[model samples]
Target chain A: MANPSNNYYDLYRHGSLGVALTDALDELIGQERIDPQLAMKVLTQFDRVIAETLQEKVKARLTFKGSLDTYRFCDEVWTFLIRNVTFKLDNGGQMVNADKVKIVSCSSKKNEEK
Target chain B: MSNTTVGPVYDTIIAEVINAVRVDFEENGVDDGALEDLKKEWQHKLSQMKVAQFPWDPKPEPQAPPAPAHAQPTAPPPTAPPTAATYTQSTLSPQSAQQTLSLPGGLLPNANPMGIKPEPGFVQAEPAIKQEPGMQPIHPGYNPANGARPTAAQRAALALESQYGQRAAASINAIHSGMQINPAAQPQQVPRPGQAPQQHMNPQQQYRQGVAASMQQRMQQVPGARPPNGLPAAQLDGLNDATDTASGPGAVHPIMMDRAQIDEHLHAQIAARAKQMEGGGLMLPLKEATKNRSLPEKPRKADGPSQLDGLDDDVKSEEDDEDAINSDLDDPDEGGDDDEDDDETMGHMMLCMYDKVQRVKNKWKCILKDGVLTVNGKEYVFHKATGEYEW
Candidate 1:
């Protein structure tokens, strides 16, 4: 019953775990193993669960600094292409470095609907 | 701090999403086994993405559960191609049957429809050189246009048979001819070709010419009212056409010969157009549009440019934007679906929710939370992230 309007963003479906789940569901549909309507129901549930899990379960923090290459804010999503980025994980002081990184961030206000 | 955290985090998301959708699976009447398969297949695909270390990766149990589901996905693709191939063969069968019907000899029970007609001119068979064999195929092809009309039950039968081959049309015609009124025609027709193939081809031709020449002589004599000697004008016209094609030697009677030519011409044209419609016609308009762009312009101008776009772009585009007669429909794409650009690149991305985002001129800062960051072939999971950058 929780659709896109009242529920969490389906935006994360573009992520790796979501993409993998979608591919799996598509294979099931292609085999006539599951109806396509059921696959959509599963995806809607995935949007709620992944958003809830990430907000509640995760605790570690990281800081990153970069020269932003391109930035666009359209609809409720903010997209940034950053160059020469450096990340410092607060847990153990480990550093991950990259030449370029693209950040896609959604509005946290939408998820705090509870 | 490390890629190790991603393994358990992803495992949690996977288990949670699956548990949530379980009731939906039940309501949809999908088996619990499909739910089980979805989990295994999901993990299998995620592992294939190799985006991070996962709890399922080190153990052999992860590989064990997906083998059955993996094999299932592979099986249907092979079956899919055969279905498409058989579809093409069915659609082409009728046309192929029509083509064979048109050819000259090796006439067996092949022209059963023609043979069933008990064609009187067919009585002078003599291998049916020119006009007769054309009658052979044209008659069978005629069945399709005919087949489209029959009673609903016959239509259903023809439609089903039409899938396998057009040979079904011939068999259906044989059934149709034997049904009620014409039941007597087939019996005498069946064995007559053996004895009748050598009969004289003279009586029909001589009679037709006798009528026409006598009409001509009478036309000169009377000069006021010319009659076909009681023969219909259509019959007289047919015999005149017959005199031209057979040249009085091809063992074809005048009446049957002219009608066959007319049917042959119509069937050939209709068959050629049908073939074109099936083959290149689908994507043809684009090709024709590109090749003959000037063709419609001429007729359109002569008939009246009342058909949209009267004013040329070079002359009148600046008068109004809405009235601009643009030649190409290169309108800008509606909305931004721009994020997919990252999918084509080497993976180094983070997807998150921003708690607070601020901008001062080009300087920007954002507090992002509950994020998945994948960079340098490693995935990092975090509850909160702070990013500062200048654009």
Candidate 2:
């Protein structure tokens, strides 16, 4: 919830992309190749960069249908448990089915206001 | 096909994040090569997830592995194995069989597990069962105050001994230990071996039999009922019946027990019996545990809609979801929270920022944008996604 630098939500650190990046940075810090402070700066830069790339470079769109099993809104974050979800990608209309998916979404406007 | 794009888009983000941080690295007196290593390490970790093709990987091989990785996740249940199905069927049929034997309202919770799933599973079952005494305030008369075992348990012990012979020895012992808490009544003998079939034992006779342990072992597991330190330590609230009753192995103290305390004792008693009947579900696959425990009666996800015929059930279930949302916002999938130990190799989760999340009572609609969505092994990025769901 605390914004370290670049004033971006670090929520995506749970995402595969962010998780992988963190692991890499952890190794660099572990070896003393990069100090912890520099690693944190790298992640802050990542926090800003990934969000920007997803917004500007990616043009794909997706639609999904699922029964909302649970939804909660607190601390400017909305968490949802979507069950029996079927996601359709617009590029070729590829369909993906899952028994359930947990969506952890933060407010998009907060980082931009910075 | 869209996955091919993740490599470039992610590569750009890594390159930019690394390049953007280089000045700080130098300012800290670090070399440029380490900066390059950081980029490569970042890319290496990304490649390890194998979520999508990376621009750095050789072209010929990327297409081969991801296809199979993607294929395996698409079919999750078949991997849960047939053992999960048998566990549910065995538990359900035996309890339903006893239901026909005049065990009224006791197994009502298990009768419609799908109905139960709509509520918080273990937490809801206990409180609902415990509320019965309050509805009829004359209930302490029925309670085993002098430490007699509840007849529901008595019947279960009988059922277990008859069905499994020596195999059910352990569960039968817990039930006997439970009965020792009673000081008032003459301890009754378990039904003699020549006892007639369960069908012949009318409700009145069955109640006199003090049958209980079996129902809770499967009918309704009383969670959080474990005795603190697993001891028959002196009853916390001094009760006259329990004064002499501590000498009895499983005797409950006869005292002025409020409903909550009574619930606690009852849960303790039921949990003891259940511990014997069902071993730890440690062997169950996460997918199986989630599917079976979350929506037990529904059985098959493909037919979830066609099965729940009652509109009332839908309405009640929605209300249950609302309660869960308000009470626990942090855990999106609270039912399967126990399975957190498993590797998150292929979890179905979407991490994105919501532009807006609006709710009109139980009906909810949210507009999520610039999201990274992963369902089934594949990863997807969307400029925007609109979701509408009730509760």
Candidate 3:
């Protein structure tokens, strides 16, 4: 099933972008310092920033030391589960049974042998 | 069981049973005195049983230690042992605590197979400080000694103070100053009698008054300034001349007439009359002559006798002649006998014969039997051939 278009706060509330910005917004609203409209505007800007960040193709090198066999990506633009893929380790062995892994970067280069 | 093994167990069991029984008695409305006596008896039996079971006292015993004071009359004596066990248990750690509890004297064999002693004092102290890992004491940041963070309400109040406090104070000061200055600038009004009260005149009234004053001043500055009277200038001139007798007849005063003027006016009137008489004498006689020649004389009879005449015979004769002519003209039969007959038959037949027949039929109160029509007491037969009722 295709995922519906969601704003940054919606995705962020589900732990996307590694920050609880929505919780901060909730606290602000709860204290009545900012109204829902202002909160929504802030959320919209955050969403735009997140969408732009996701769209940019940047070179990043990551060293993952775990055994995670399955991973999933979710957001407004992309939503899919990744599984059963081989990953190279900086220390010379591969792990396949990790529970959680972080995606460091994406590049067009083929895997290089050390 | 051997006395060494059963001594603490028996003491513990007996203490628990006494406690249970005491609780049951208290719950069932046992008086405090009876409960105390029962508690003393149980303590004596428990001490005696401990003495009988363990002759070799591990610790030096007082000759007769007073019965252990019961903090709660219904709590077991084994409660204290658990506190000691917990102290030991904490020091020995889990591995050694398990080894200690696995010793032969453990009360619950399979339940605590590791032979860990129950910390009964922990139960008493449970409400004060729970032993569970998750039940750690919460150190609230709002301690007076440490300095407390502001609460949400206090923060909101502070924010409002920052935002509007100065403005509110300034406004209050402004109001105070305005109140202080207002009375000094205002004039106190005192009313006076006999002076016509000053009415507030609107702009329109003021404009009208200004116009009237200007007009009065202009009038006063005129060369021959007249009193502001109701009469107009032209009328005033005539009035002045009329009242001034000094203006002689030759002077031609507007009101006074001259004798030569009267004579001239009379001569003009006489000439006008003479001219009118000449025109009328010539035209009128000619008009009368033409009229008398062209029109024939009307008959005196056609004019009829005057109604004002006192002669009754002439009036009567004229009225008789008028009646005779009117009667002769009004007679429609004069036109034709056939028309007269038609009008008479059509106009009179329905009104006379049909009405009389309808009245007769209405008048007849009758009933018919066979062909006879009965009316009142008379029986009349309907004759079809003659189309009439026959007796």
Candidate 4:
């Protein structure tokens, strides 16, 4: 399997957030709202801080019920296995056990804080 | 880190900055309403930034005017930074001026430094209807002009009509008009004499009428018998007409036999025959005659075994002989002292003889006493110790 980190990096480079951040920074440099060099330094630092904060938030949310043996972060989502979770089915109003459940969490730090 | 992850991080930083700005405005005694307007302006600016294309590297030529508001930010600008410029810069080196002057080689060979516009084919096509945030667009093939198709039940009814419509309508119309498809198809019923005239007669009734007509014609052709006691012919004809009318067409006159009168006549003939046979001495009853008639003897063949004949002769002789023997046995003074001596010895001899007979017959029921062996109601005595009997 391809490395999940590589996939995430590709997504960060090409995705909407990357484009939006680059556009905002370029506009600020054009308007001379702040020094280009200082702004670049701050932006890189901000990116590091946000990644750490999101990773922490995601880890906390994942292990809220219990700790998992393995989890993966890929393509803007966190995937992990859980056990004995109850899920409501759409067919009938029935609740069933989801053994070895695979959960996909795309929730970010902003959403979590909100 | 994914681009989706970057969105939340950017939101957090922006929130922190807003908080700092609010604090500054409050310290400067700015109006709360002004702060709200500033917040709205900042949101608008963020939306605009999301719509713009990113240029990671500084272009050698002057940049073109900004793109239309409708353009999406899916494609990277031609003047985007090389891979090394964008991501390979070491965080330890804060010397931006020296790094900018010393341009890195062998990084992102495809990078265009002139900021060229993208080809028309490279730009993504936009949908006719613009969707708002959180809203999904409807399917492109759906048309509002076409009304809703018929339900399942309606479609089934329409299919049935298409296949069997004409025949069903004809049958319904026939029922309303009171017309029968086959008039003579019903079951035939027997007609009574006084009932209304029937429109149709079955084959059996027609055959019976034809036979009756022929019989009546034959009767008319025959000469009438001489009228009794000088009765008029017209009166006789009137009597025949009355019988015909009373019996109706195809009806035969019933002839009833009187059982009592016939029985009396037969009994007279039987008595005369009995008187002739017996010379008026005795007459065998009719019941005896019937029994004899029912049990006719089967004749025996001349050459076959004569056992049946011998049995009849034996039965007659036994009956006659038994009467004579019983009378002789009843006499007490027929024998003298010689008989008395014989009688005592006869007792021993009779017992021996009975034993021998019992052995031969395999039956023992005789008792000997006073020279006599009694069996059932009969008695037997030994004459000379021989198995012969003198009853």
Candidate 5:
């Protein structure tokens, strides 16, 4: 999985917000090109970081976070979570080329981690 | 007492005559044949009257008065008046004696003291008769003897002959003329027994109709109140305030408001936000606070770029406060780029950044934070750092 292969490219793809974030982070940090699976794992990890922070800001009590794409948060506290955060990998980078971030949930304060 | 002397004799004679007539008819069995023979005899006797033969007269007809101009002027033929004795004798002849019949005084003068002229042709038949065509001979399978039963088409024709038919046609014509018919003015027919009357809504429905009409009228009158085309409330605010002032002290304040009022304001704000999310058009009321406040004194527009000069004092102060917070958070010696130490630190930083990013994951996603971080719902120990770098 560490090395890129045609077989890996041909395999099924399930991309998400977390995957994109991890890809951007790895592109910046990892010297050796990382495999798509590892890239997705890292992206999912970053997404959890965002969700957890928003959980604190909005004062949402975390209920659960799962692997196959599930996160739940406390009631009525999700708006603050989405407002003060950004999905960009680099806030200072050019607006057009910056990486995209997507917040999947707010009221449910759960954060997903790989 | 004196009138009784003549009345007894007259009564006896009348009684005998009536009895004799009844008995004779019963014995002879007077039928259609006898009645027709009597009619023919009367018509023949009437033909004998020597009427003046006017050259224009086609036949002898009963004398009648001149007609009014507008009337269809049918000229009457000249004829001799028949004597009472002759009129009586014609109807009472022995050949017709067995027939039981009575002629109206209006048709034969001999039957009454009132001078009634005999109808130009008939001397004994009842004059007050209406002629109805017996079952149409051309229509086969039609029973001529029974007058009551009618075919479907005949029944419909009979129905259309009633007053209701004319009324229905008149109503349809009125509608075609574009004349509004008053609902109350229409005539209603009583339903047949065991049938329900027409279904109609009561006053409540009428009230609803009235309310709907009033609402539509008001909406039509206030053309500018339509949404999307309506003027911004902010533009109208000053006018509203002036009006409110002119209204009196009891008037609601234009600016000051309570929590409920503020809630209304916030509701409008929330609605605007939602609309913005949906890509709908919005109009925000202008802020009077910005209008009244003077431009910051840092520099005039001519002395520097307008963007900088236009910055309000309050915004500059807020930025200064943010800068102070950043400087305090910044760790000393954070500038060192020791490669191996940096790599380990970068890896740790990446890990820490992931934790922070996950913390805010619900609001913002696809993000990384490198400074102080949170991990597994817990705030982790971190050395805060701040630096300016170009990408």
Candidate 6:
């Protein structure tokens, strides 16, 4: 009868949080006009966003105040993000493929001294 | 009945009767023409009866001789006790004859209630009473409540029963607590044939205690332990999902199809892609057969994008790119199929691809601001709480 603050345990039992987060992030990334690489860095910093969100939701009482990568405890945050955020795109919008953005590397031309 | 009616009303009544007859004939399988003739005959008889004036009285039909009526009931004289005289008289009573009626060749219940005027010699056949196969007839009269209620003596017995149960429970508890060490001591005294040597006991006990202590510590840490920390509740689902790959075909997530789309787009960019698979509707079985056919990969020389044919060719190329990539993938032995390889690389290329896509789709700020964002041509209208928009 004890409901854990994050209910990560129940979420794990019922569904895969990682798959869910991957799905949510795919939708979020697809809709953004920003560079895909930067979008990823933002998603990687989800712990910070989660911590801030939880602080707001809980009014700072149940704080997930911990360092990035150190909060082995924030698995619940990942679970919460996945369960609450992952969604299908409107009008059947799809995950943006990195291949869609072809990387065309060009070297700068130097002025020739004649 | 007055016979003054001589108008459309008579026609209406006749029509209604005809309709009713038709419906009854359809429903009940009676001939309408025959019933109509019978109705006419009945009407003719009624008219004659009316002319003759209603008969005041009718005579009752003659009755058959009521076979010797059974003897009347008489109260049995109460005797001092069951004596020989009363027993002999009881056997000769008319009630004893009634009991004999239950035997074979005796009266059976009516077989057909619908049949009228049954023949005298007709014998009723009893319906077969079907007993459920392999099932016993449960005695409906049996009651569990009868056993539940206890007399004084029964209560005393129950008290003894509880006393014994408590004694047994206490004995079990004592053994569990190591109070009764008879089983343990016997091992040392008798040196049982398959028992481990006593020298190993101390180490084994220490190892068991270590295991138990570790398990208890884990149970306590589990609540606070973060995800992937080996906590029972940790969100190690990513690890779990990696283990299962042989799931059904449809089990591949829709996201995987999007991954496939990368291959699609790459193939579309290729100019020399050909339309291998047919596009229009075909019989389902034929289409399925075509899908199954393992046609050898057609080797096409790669030409530059300038080889693109026409305006329609652009659209066709875009659609066929996916098929081209897939066909290219179909034969991995060929050095070609770089398009598909590019698709496989897309996952690593965009790290936060999924996360970014999710955020873009989500109108979080709008929800936070309690407003909406309208996207127009080259402009974003941000409507706030005041119901106004700004670029």
The candidate that wins on TM-score is 2
TM per candidate, chain B: 0.29, 0.31, 0.13, 0.13, 0.11, 0.11
Q: Write the per-residue lDDT of candidate 2 for residues B1-391, one digit (tens) a residue.
A: 3577777888898888887887888999999989888778878777777778888987754443444443222122332321222222223333432443443433221232322222222342334434332111111112122223444554455456444534664675466446434423423222222222331333222221221211122123333343323312211211222223323433343333234344543443453344334343335576444322323222222234643233334334434544544456646565566245123423888888888777898777788888998766667788888877675
Query: Cα lDDT of model 5 overall?
Result: 0.25
C-alpha TM-score for every candidate? 0.45, 0.46, 0.18, 0.17, 0.13, 0.12
Candidate 5 chain B minimal-lDDT segment of 10 residues: B138-147
Cα lDDT of all candidates, in order? Answer: 0.56, 0.55, 0.28, 0.29, 0.25, 0.24
Cα RMSD for predicted model 2: 21.4
In candidate 5, which residue ranges exceed 4 Å CA deviation? Answer: A1-98, A101-114, B1-302, B305-309, B329-391
Candidate 2's displacement at residue B81, Å, is 28
Please give the clash total of every predicted structure, in order: 3, 18, 7, 0, 27, 17
Chain B TM-score of candidate number 5: 0.11
Per-residue lDDT tens digits of candidate 1, residues B241-278? 33332333222354465575455444434544554555
- Consecutive 10-residue window with the lowest summed lDDT within model 1 chain B: B199-208
Please provide, for model 3 over B162-220, each residue's C-alpha lDDT reduced to its tens digit, 9 standing for 90 to 100: 33543333443333233323222211111111111110111111111211222222222
lDDT by residue (A1-114, candidate 2, tens digit) is 114456787887888888888888888888988888877877788888888888888887777778787667799888787778788777876678888888889998886888
Per-residue CA lDDT of candidate 1, range A1-114, in tens? 455524688777878888889999999999998999889888888888878788888888999999887788999889888888999889877788888888888999977674
**Residues A1-114, model 5: lDDT tens digits:** 112222111100111222223334344335433334433433333333333332332221111111212122344221111111111112222111111111222212122321
Interface RMSD of each: 1.3, 2.1, 61.5, 61.0, 50.4, 35.0
RMSD of each: 21.3, 21.4, 61.4, 59.3, 49.1, 41.8
Model 5: lDDT of residue B89: 25
Candidate 1, number of clashes: 3
How high a TM-score does candidate 6 get? 0.12
10 residues in a row with least lDDT, candidate 1 chain A: A1-10
Expressed as tens digits, the lDDT of each residue in B1-391 for candidate 5 is 0111112222232233223333333444434343233223322322222112222234544454466543211111112111111222223332221111222321111122111122223232212110111111111111111111122432232233222433333342333223212222211111111111111212111111112222222223332243322223322321232233223332133223344445543443454455455443223223422221222222232234553233333345434434444554444424332223333322111122222223433332322222222221112211222211111
Chain A of candidate 6 gets a TM-score of 0.25
Worst lDDT 10-window in candidate 4 chain B = B138-147
* Docking level of model 4: incorrect
